[model samples]
Structures are given as C-alpha cells and as structure tokens.
Target: MNAELVEQYRLLHERRPDYGSGASHVERIAAIIERRGVRSVLDFGCGKGALVERLRARFPEVVVDGYDPAIRGRERIPLERYQMGYEMVIANDVLEHLDAEGYGEDLLEMGRLEPRWLFFNISCRPAVNVLPNGVNCHTLVRRPEWWREVLLACFPGFIEHGSEWNERSKGWMLAMTRPLELEGRRVAIVGNAPQAMGNREDVDGFDCVVRFNNFVVGDGYEAVGTRTDVLAIPACNRAVITPRLKRFTEGVSYVLDLATAGCVQAKANHGKIRQLLPHATIV
Candidate 1:
C-alpha cells in the first residue's frame, strides 16, 4: 500500500472500540503464518491497525502495511496514493463488507501487488443450525464458497491444504497453503456433518460441503441435509476452516469464572485481540 492509502486504513480503525476480546485469534493466525517466512503483507481491513501491530511484533522484520475504506482517523492510511504489491495478504473479518468495488477492483488492484499467499477470515454460521447472529457489529455474512472461487481464480497456484473452523462460531477459519500442484485437485469432508447446534434453519454446521449439496436441491439452499453429495469445499476449493490450536500458538490463554462466554483477558502478544472471544475454543 502507498503511504497515503495506508494512512487512510489506519484512520478508520481508530473509532471502533477494541471489541474482539480474547481467543488469541491474532497469534494463532500469526503462528500458522510464521511458518511461511513472510516478508511483506497487506493487512486488509486492518482495524485500528491492531492485527498489523501483532504481526509486526511477532514476525519482527516482516514489512506489514494495512488498508480499510471505512476509517477516517488521524493515524490511518488514506490508501488512495498507495502503489505497491505484497508477498502475503491478511484480511480477517473483511469479506462481509466487500462490494464489487472492494472485492473485485480492490483485489485486482492488490493482486497486482503479487502476494504469494493470503491469510483471510470470513463470516460464517455453523451448518449445525446455530443462531441468527450477523447483526453483531461487523459481520457481512457472505457465502464461504464465493470466497474460494474468487481467491482461486485470482491465485490459481495455491490451495488451502489444511484449515480449521470453529464450528461454534459458524465462521470458517483457515490457513491458505500455497498450492503444490492443482491438476484436478478435489477435497471432501471425511466424517458425518456435525449435528445442528440449534433451530435456525439457515444456520447449519460448518461442513460447507452441505452448502454445495444445496446445488442439487434447487437454487437456494433447501435444507442442510438435502444437499449431501457436494463436498464441504468447492471442487476447485481445497479447504475446510477448522478451529485454531490453543497451545501451539505463541501465548497462553486465560479465562474467567462466569458461565457467559464473553470475557476479556490479555496476553504478551502485542495487540488487543489477544484478549479471548467468549466461547472461543481451539481446534
């Protein structure tokens, strides 16, 4: 990102309160990424520049820049005059806000940056029939498959080799592994889909193969079970967002005594999100 644009992204993050309490989501993501020896990255939707701060703290010398169209703060990057590409891209909780202008043009613009790998997270609901929760502040709730098709077509050389999704969040969390080879590659969920968590019919378990299974029933996803033959990931897609590893990450997690899952705890990892998210569990 150019210096001015980077300034704009940072500006927006300044207003939002530090919300993603706990769960080491940032570090766990960094841990999975540290293995790559990343040099530079584009932290898309870098709210408060918090995640970028964590990435910098952990990776040390890695060059990390960010962008967010919503920000208008003093410490943010404007993103208008930015001119550069990145080796890696980090865009957590960014998809739900995308328009054809953002995901389409913005990505094509970023693609020119030539990022070898992208670390992104999107809004998702469990195939387990969870809850109607998108209204919670920042989630845009797009189809997980749409993400795969766009990314795959953009970066045809890579594949999501192994990823974990927190079934409870219904959100797909993953590590997009660089593609080794993509000749007729296929992926499928190996076990029985998780039982739906509650009664919201639209909210199903994270076994996205069920999402595609909907293709056979009609246009709209009829019911989770009606679409079975389709895999959790797209035929071209090679991943399933699973949970993160708790201990494998750089820091230790802490918890509170209350039964309610929403609680905040801090860690040495250099960012606010190091605080845990309620009901957040490691895969």
Candidate 2:
C-alpha cells in the first residue's frame, strides 16, 4: 500500500465519514458468490466492513475477510489479517476513489492476491458524497471501456464480464475470471471469401474452426463446414455483423477489433454495436 495514497483516503474519510454505506451492494455480491460456488472471498476495499459482516451472517460456512486502509482502525480489520489466494476478490465502489498515480498500484496489489475471480463495482459518475474541498468522492470517474482497458493491462488472459447494470442499486458492476489456457491448440481461420468455398473437410480437420465476419454455412454446409468455434468481426462492420450475431452466435467466442479493422469513415462509430460488443478483446 502506498503511504501517500492511504493518507489521502484517510483525509477523505474524515471529511465524508458516511461515504461507505454499501449494504445493498453486499446483497448482490453475496448472490453471485452463492451462484458461482465461491467458498472464500477477500473484500479488497471493504468500506466499514459491511459486506464482510453480511457474508459471515448469511453464509457461515464460507470464509470472508476485509481490508480497508481508510477505516481500518475504526470499522475494518487490518490488511495483514487476511490470507492471499481467495476464491474471489471484490473491490466494490473502490477503484474510482484512488488518485491517478495510485490507480495502477492498487490494481497490482489486487492482482498479487491471485484470486480465481475478481469483481469490481466502480462508480463512473460523480458521487453524492463530497470532500471538505467540495470535490466528489469519486476522484477517478471514467467510462466503462476505459476501466476495461486498465483491467486488461493487469490481467490479459482473464475473461471479462462487461459492465452490467444493477437494477437494485442503479449502479454498474464489472467482473473478470481467470480462464483456462489453450496452449499449442490448432485452429483454422476460415474467411468469408470465395477461397473458403470447398475447404470444409480441411477446416473441420483442425481442433477448432474460426469464421470471419458475416459468414454463412447453411448455403454450402458440406463445402463451408457447419462448425463455428469462434467468430472474428471487425469493429466497423456492425451493419453486416449485428443481425447475424444475434441469430446464430450464442456461446461462441467472438474476437473483435476495437478500431476499424479495414477502413471506415468516422473516427469513432457512436452506434449500438459498441454496447453490444463490450466484452470483445481489442486486437
């Protein structure tokens, strides 16, 4: 933990003492733990130890611990009390509070814990709570995509569960889980061009067959192949890709480029495709 960053939070907490009420948030988190069969959890920035108490009360069999630098003496237990390598590590409403310089360090510390699953509930908007200087408690408010980018930098292989809206709390929650590796796996990339017309047998011979944007199989199943292990789509080709995706690509691994794969007019396509493909890994 950075001493300067800790001091900053300590001062912020002194100014806005009641800024850490996350009881409703705890309920949602607990539900996830139960559904996912998570036996152990470490609440990284457990404000006031609210979630820790609730987890123990609701699920006595499960092990839960908390760490909060700001409220450690008063409401939270010290960081040293908890052991590393929890089944899940949660940092609810915490990332947005860090200073610019401390953000990467904080994320690194969370990564060092080496949890199987990591949950982050970050407030992208301004907080209701204000400091003595009249600044919002959320100092590092950013768009969901920006947060995802920062997270990917720290954990590249992890599978992301994109920003999902919580109707109960009216907030967004982001999650990522460590994925099983596929080392030296043979995969055939089948494009939508005419060359892939009669190569079904060769394509299907591989362990997995990957299809490119807006591909068809029903027309020539014998020639084009029926199996689609993965779908690779460019960011700007949404008009041709969106409807096909909804109709066919459930449970399919989608590989998408963040920018225009080939060429597009607009610098940024402010369309529904961006929201639809939120969890896509940037190529």
Best by lDDT: 2
Please give the lDDT score for candidate 1. Answer: 0.46
Tens digits of per-residue lDDT for model 1, 1-283: 3344334334433433553212236865665456556677777666556777777887778777766655444233334424556767767866654543445665566566666676767666322221133223332455667677777687655555344566667666544544322234332222333343222353224322212211232234244323232222222222221122222212211111212123332222112111222122212
lDDT of each: 0.46, 0.67
Task: Output the worst ten-in-a-row residue range by lDDT, candidate 1.
Answer: 269-278
Give candidate 2's whole-model lDDT: 0.67
lDDT of 2 by residue, 237-282 (tens): 8667868666555435434344553346223432322332333322
Per-residue error (Å), model 1, residue 73 = 5.8
TM-scores, one per candidate: 0.49, 0.58
The number of clashing residue pairs in each candidate reads 53, 0
Runs of candidate 2 exceeding 4 Å displacement:
1-5, 12-17, 74-83, 165-170, 180-283
Q: lDDT of model 1 at residue 249?
A: 18
